[model samples]
Target: MDSSSLLKEYPLNPVVWDEMCVQNEVRAPYHKVYEFLKQISTEDLTRKEEMARRLFMNQGITFTVYSSGEGIEKIFPFDVIPRIITAAEWDFIERGIKQRLKALNLFLKDIYHNQFILKDGVVPIEMIYSCPHFLREMHQLNVPHDIYVHIAGIDIIRDADGEFYVLEDNLRTPSGVSYMLENREITKRIFPDLLPQNNVRTVMQYPQLLYKNNPNGLLGVAGLMSAYRKGNVAIVNAPGNGVADDKAVYIHVPAMIKYYLNEEPILKNVPTYQLNNPDEQAYVFENMARMVIKKTNESGGYGMLIGSAATEKEMEDFKVAITANPREFIAQPIISLSSAPCYLNGKLQPRRIDLRPFALCGPDGIEIVPGGLTRVALREGSLVVNSSQGGGSKDTWILSK
Candidate 1:
């Protein structure tokens, strides 16, 4: 039997299926992807996967999971489809991300030092006060570079019109950048033709850029604000950042902005209510069915309660827990997350997903990576995009044209 007959016999193996036949004649993007995959053999693809696994292991690129006991490191799941981004599209995304990061950094500084934005009524004081993430301990404290956000992964999603909008900001210890670099390497081996044909820009240099020229470099925030007499150089990613990234600490961001920057914030935060605030807590206690509650500092897909998905007993338990310690939780209205085409089983299906584009701050200016990690909720119709919760990732290729 030839390759076609072999494929008919073994339809479950993706490697065999892809190599056995010519894909349907599609348009530009899909045609391009299929053509590239056809050039590599099934055995070659397996070899590439092994190489990727070795590369990750040699580089010590692993994340710690707590439940498996402390110091249990695991490799992140790698996907073969390398998302491509064009130069022209990258230009727009880069500018937007930089502008947003700059404004947010300035906002954090101002909220901690002066109440200008709050006083001016651009953002309500109650919103800041009611945030579960607001860190009172950071008030009037000097961050070495006057920069609270050292690394940022701003989440964005494209709507039906194909326009992108900011969904949320991952300021503290944003993960998945490692996966971005590794994905590029894996794709290059599996589909070498995809790069030259698509004119994809190289993103391998990003990690090095992040390590060097940290915002806390010698020349500090003096240029942005003149209130501080001395500049201190400290890497914000010092030990204990895990504790700081908690959702409860988020409430203090606005206050951190006022107390440290002595200016007003330009960007707006999502409307939130702390379960601890007396009035807000009471309101949440009364209307548990209308809100999406989240634990202050949990990462991945854990510790979340979608009002529509909770049982009566669970809702009652949550109310009791909030009454005991409201500071540990926050609530927001559900925003419909975006979706994209994904290859599931054997067909293309719509999967709910989100994007996380990275931003860097330096004396010259801010740099935002044009391409982001497009994460999909692997389970059918699921909205959670975290890799820890049976989710998969795709490459985001920004169109050059």
Candidate 2:
């Protein structure tokens, strides 16, 4: 039999864009590797897939999966077929990312110093003071270059329309970069020639880039912020940046972009409802089952209510929490996050995914690594892709074409 005839059948979800193919045919950026895949026998393909897993195992490339109230180190699930973005798409994404960072860093600096965005009424003072991480101590404290956010891991996602959106920004110390770099190294081994054939961009310089831009050594956000305040040290994603990452503050991002950069936002956020707004809160509470509510300051996927899955007790508890301090929360319709093909149970299946591209700011300026970590919800149909919440990662390829 010919190599094409030996290919294993993989089900495709037509509702979402498949990065590998436009329809049944392989997408242009993936042509080189899809053709290569057609030539591999199923047995040999399985062996190669298994080898990829073994390589991860041997290299100790693992992430802690904390589920069911316990932590377990598991080999981060990696798919051999990478998620590819065209050069045009990447250029647009890069511009949007840089625009966002510039505005956000300026916003942070403004809130801590002049409070201009607040005084001008671009963002409410309550929203600034309402943020749990908003440090009063940061007032009038100056940092090198007036740049507050040295590193940002902005969460990005594509919907059915095939447009990119910034889901959220991780400014207070972004994670998963190690997984991103490792994913590229593994992809190199899986399809050594496919990369050069596709003219894929490299992500190996992220660590060095971060090192060159951020503090040489630091512990926690507050400590680093304190050091920078005293002119004794420098920090990345400088502390008190939580003011921007706060889900409540997230709603004001577009306004912030317009206010600070005076530029329209190239990327947008999912429609969010601030519980602090009486009308929005009423709608959110009444339609609790249709929305996802999150605490403004919480991270690591905690303090969240998946309205569709919440039990009566959980709903009541969340309602009480919202009632006690409404400003601490925000709600959004549960987005049917786009799905991508993932290898699972010895077969290719669809899984919801999200991307987090890291942006670095220095005297040189904002630089985003062309590649990022493609986090996949390993469990069938699950939307939460955080490693702490049973998510795995994949390699992302930004094609030169």
Candidate 3:
């Protein structure tokens, strides 16, 4: 089938923005990809996808899912269609992440030392003391360069209007970067000259950038924890970062940007409501169906409830849990995440996706290699994109000027 036929088969959600198509016309960044697809038959695309999958299988690129005290290894899903971002979009994302990190690093330094943000009544002192991740031993302990967040994988999502919002910051051992690099390599094999033809920027520099800063490079090595205790190796992301990346602390990040960096945040945070507040809790309880309730310390799509998708039992269970320990929960409005086209079952389909771009901070500066891991909700009409929750991934392309 022609690209027009493929485009016609792919349905767009009127309420959700599409990355590749706007009113059935392919967007500028996807022009080259669209043209390439125009000449390929549907069978050809399926073959390419199959080839990509086999390569992943052969290469043993997989993630483990734990269940019943056992680990199940599964191949990480790879979609043929790449999620393309323009040069302008990438620049905005890079700048925003850098700005946020600067503030976060400063916040960590301040919190562990003077606790100025808390003392000045900026962030509630109770919030810090109550946080499970806050270590009392870290108080007044000086780290190298006083930098806590060295490497970051900040999760960013686009809303219905195509506006970017940071969903969360992962300052501690952020995962999925290997998949990002491998996706690009796999694309190079499947798409051949398409990447260069589209002027896509390379993500291969990620490893080099990482090693450049970590001369010791002892992460993931056996006895690394013992070495860390002896101060024999430096942790890229220092301890006590949980005090900064805590979901409860996320609400105060904009204030941190203004307080520490002396500038407004370039990217907006998704409007979040702390369930501990009486007013916010009342509002969320009243509009439970339109909110997503999550535990402050949870990750991997666990300990969360999607209100719209939750059953009566799930909602009631969450209500009881939140009421028991109000500080452990927060809620946000259900954002209609932007969708992108995916190749599945020999046809183009729309799926919700989110991006997690890795940013490396060294003594010199912060550098974000172009492109990231584009996680997709493979299920129809789902919003959650965690791999443990049956989500897949797409190659992200950041085009050059």
Candidate 4:
């Protein structure tokens, strides 16, 4: 069988965009990859994927997933197929994300300083004040180079329309670039022939993109913040940025961009409803089965309720929780996140996935490593892609054109 026939054997979800092959047509950026894979045997391909998993585990590239009372450290799942983005597509994504982050950084500074946006009514003042990550102590404090968002993991997801939307902003200590770099390394070993002869545009800035393993978690947050304030060391993501990414605060980011940059957002936010609004709350509560509810401050895919997957008891419990503290929650129509082919269970399977590109805002400016982490929902038909939520990582490739 040819490449087309082999790949088409796996059914593509009708509602999601396939990153590699679309309706029997290989996308331009993935054309080379399709040809390359055509010559490889399925058994050999399976072997390589298994090898990749072992390599990740041996390198200690893992995240702990807790269940009941146990913390289990498992090697993050790796998909051998590269998710390719064309040069033009990447240019749009790169520019749009940099713009969004700039707007968010300005918003953070403004919120911490004069509260201009709030005073102007571009964003509700109560939204900021109610945010759990909003820190009053950072008011008037200066971040080195005036860049509050040193590192950001801006999650991008494609809906059924194949348009990318900024799913969420990871402003405070965004993890996963480690996996990005690791994925590239493993790819190097797995596809040495293709990468060497052709200089595929990969995440080349390794030194700057990778984050130090934070063994201490929040215990280190205080020390890092103090040193940051003192100018002793510039933290990658300046402290107190969590407020900007708070789910409730995220909905207003486009407004922040408009207010601060005076430019329309290049990337649109997923339509979100702040539970604090009585009308929005009523709508969300009435349509609980069609919405995905999340706590404004939650991360690592925690504190989320997938309406389609939730049990009735869980919905009742979550509805009561949201009702009890409406300001703490936000809801969005469950988006059909794009899918990618993953080598799992000894076969190529379609898995829901999202893109998280890491942005480094240094003294110079924002420099994004070509492709970031492509997190996959390892389970069948799942949307949650955090590694902690049984998700996996894939090497993302930005074609050289």
| Top of the candidates by TM-score | 3
Per-residue CA lDDT of candidate 1, range 188-220, in tens? Answer: 765566777876666676876776647334333
TM-score for each of the candidates: 0.69, 0.92, 0.97, 0.93
lDDT of 4 by residue, 307-351 (tens): 989999999999899889998889999999988877776667888
Q: Each candidate: RMSD to true structure?
A: 7.7, 2.6, 1.6, 3.1
For residue 247, model 2's alpha carbon misses the true position, in angstroms, by 1.1
Error of 2 at 354 (Å): 0.9
Candidate 2, 1-401: lDDT as tens digits: 14443233556677776666556666677677667766766567677789899999999988775556677888877777677788999999999999999999889888888888889888999878867889887888887888888888999988778888988889887898888988888778877887888888899988788788774646565665557768887766566878888888889999989998888999998889988788888898899998888988777688899999899889889989998899888898987777776756655577888899988999789999999888888888677888777788888989875
Q: What local distance difference test score does each model get?
A: 0.60, 0.82, 0.90, 0.83
Lowest summed lDDT window (length 10), candidate 3: 224-233
Off by over 4 Å in 3: 217-232
- Give the poorly placed runs of model 1, Cα more than 4 Å off: 1-31, 34-60, 68-71, 84-92, 121-146, 159-163, 215-232, 237-291, 323-327, 341-350
Cα error of candidate 4 at position 48, Å: 0.9
